[model samples]
Target: MSTPARKRRGRRAYIAGALAEEQVARYYELRGLQLAHRRWRGSRGEIDLVLRDGDAVVFVEVKSAPTHARAAESLRPAQVRRIMMTAQEFLGREPRGELTEMRLDVALVDGQGVIEIVENALSDF
Candidate 1:
């Protein structure tokens, strides 16, 4: 049950998220990380980006807003937990399995399109 306006807003959010992911992906690519997967999802949750940085795997969560602080604040603790769980699921399915080092990172995109990457944003459980 949805109204046209709500549907439109949802579509706009999806487009914004897609743009943010693309911007963040390019930023990582320029730094030599290969794109392992984009929008990796499991029953646990969805990870915005999964990248291989050398021998380590980087799981990224991208947030976009009018300001960096706003974008950073958009991520909830529950969401992080889900992302971490999804990351575990992703790793278990990988060919390398749990052999590689893994890290969680966050990428914030501002309205002006500036990209900021926060590395190792989460501590391992």
Candidate 2:
């Protein structure tokens, strides 16, 4: 049983997430990366943004919260695994397949809409 208030909150979160993704995409684009896909979904999971930097593929996970640190902390280990799996699925479509060079980045958006990009945020994964 979903209440009206709950639905409204869910809608608001969705909108905020969408906006954060958009902001992150623009941030990368300004830095010379070309947007390849937005909200790319695979059997494993969804990748918020996929960009191309030369021949390298950059998979970005966008997070939004009251603070940048909170946004960064929101990405759990389970989600990291899912993102990695999804990234591999996405790479399967590339010309080099799984051999394609790639990196995972986390983009954190604060309440005021400021963006902070953590490059290679999941290098150890």
Candidate 3:
């Protein structure tokens, strides 16, 4: 079979991403953290979302791939570096905030419309 042309992400993928982001936000909200930002942008990079979990400041990275493996895999080394740098820039803008409690988190998506939140999965940054 002629390899069925790989389906590029279109409206459906966009919808999935949006839905995942929203669900992640809801989860963080229920956990007592306020969703301070959604799709926050900076010169260095873009942060998917930010939440305040009590005294903690969380920088969220939301990934919505077809499967959990693919989704989690997307957060490769390069991407992590960018996210970290971007987070630094993001924090620079809010110097008054508590930088000591800053953290980076990932929200991975599966094909079943489920989101798995992985907190501090990476130790590097």
TM-score of each: 0.92, 0.95, 0.83
Which sections of candidate 1 miss by over 4 Å?
Answer: none
lDDT per residue as tens, model 1, 14-122: 9999999999999999999999999988999999999998878999999999999999999888998999889999889877887768999999999999988888886
Superposed Cα deviation of residue 124, candidate 2 (Å): 3.5
Give lDDT tens digits, candidate 2, residues 1-125: 57998999999999999999998999899999999999999999999999999999999999999999999889999999999999999999999999999999999999999998889998776
Who is ahead in TM-score, 1 or 3? 1
Error of 2 at 105 (Å): 0.0
| True-vs-predicted CA distance for residue 66, candidate 3, Å | 3.2
Whose TM-score is greatest here?
A: 2
lDDT of 2 at 98: 95
- Sort every candidate by lDDT, greatest first: 2, 1, 3
For residues 23-124, could you state the per-residue lDDT of candidate 3 as single tens digits?
Answer: 889988988899988988887778889888766679999998878889988887887887888878877767464454788989997878788988886555
- TM-score of candidate 1 on Cα atoms, chains taken together: 0.92
Q: What's the lDDT for residue 66 in model 1?
A: 94
The Cα local distance difference test for each model comes to: 0.91, 0.95, 0.81
Error of 1 at 109 (Å): 0.2
Looking at model 1, report the run of 10 residues with the lowest lDDT sum. Answer: 116-125
